[model samples]
Target: MRSMPNTNTRNLHELSADIAAVVRDVVATGEDAVITDDGTEVAVIMSMADYDRLHLYAELADAARPGYAGATEFRAMSISEMLDVLGVHPTVDRGLRG
Candidate 1:
C-alpha cells in the first residue's frame, strides 16, 4: 500500500480565508490538506492524482476482503461503515452520508 505524505491541517475558518492558496499548495506539493472545524477534523483536500490513487487502492482492498460486495453496493452503506472499510476512524465528526 502506498502511504500518503504528511498532511497539512487547517481550521475551516483559515481555509475559507485562503482557499486558493491552500488549493495551490495541495496541487503543487502533492500533500493533502486536512480541514478542521472547531478543532475537529472534518474534510480533506487532495490532488486529483492522489484521490485516484487512493480510490484504486480502496477498490483493491475491498476486493481482497472476504464477502466483499461490488462498488455500487458498497456506496450504499452507511457513512460509518464506508469509513471503516476505508480504514478511517468511524468516531470522527464527519458529515453524514446516507
Candidate 2:
C-alpha cells in the first residue's frame, strides 16, 4: 500500500501530510520519488526491481576494484562500506541480503 518512488519531488512536510497519496502515485508510475527536507534531498522511493538491479551493479563493480576480493569478501562488506566505495550519496539504509 506504499508508494513507489518516481518523478515528482516532495518536501518532508508535503509527504508527511499525505504519505499514502504520494506512495500511491509512485506505485502507479514505477518511477522515483525524491523526498527532501528543508529543500535538501533526504530520501528516495523507487521500485524494488530498480533497487535490486542497482545492488547487483554495485556488487559487480566492487569486484573489479583494486584489492579486489571474491564474492564472499564483497558480500561480507557492509552496505555503508560498499556505498562509500561507490560514492553514492548518503542516507540510504537498505542493502542486498545474502
lDDT of 2: 0.66
Candidate 2 lDDT, tens digit per residue, 6-95? Answer: 257888887888888877776676656888889877788776766886788686767767677543443466655676777764444345
Residue 4 alpha-carbon offset, candidate 2, angstroms: 16
Model 2, residue pairs in steric clash: 3-23, 4-27, 5-31, 5-32, 5-33, 5-45, 6-31, 6-32, 6-33
Give per-model TM-scores. Answer: 0.63, 0.60
lDDT of 2 at 2: 34
- Model 2 lDDT, residue 21, Cα: 84
Query: Any runs in candidate 2 off by more than 4 Å, and if so which?
Result: 1-6, 70-98
Model 1: what TM-score? 0.63
Report the Cα lDDT for residue 92, model 2: 46
The positional error of residue 12 in candidate 1, measured at the CA in angstroms, is: 0.1
The residue-by-residue lDDT of candidate 1 on 1-98, one tens digit each, is 12234578878987778999999998877667888889877888988876775578567667866667543444345444555777776344333211
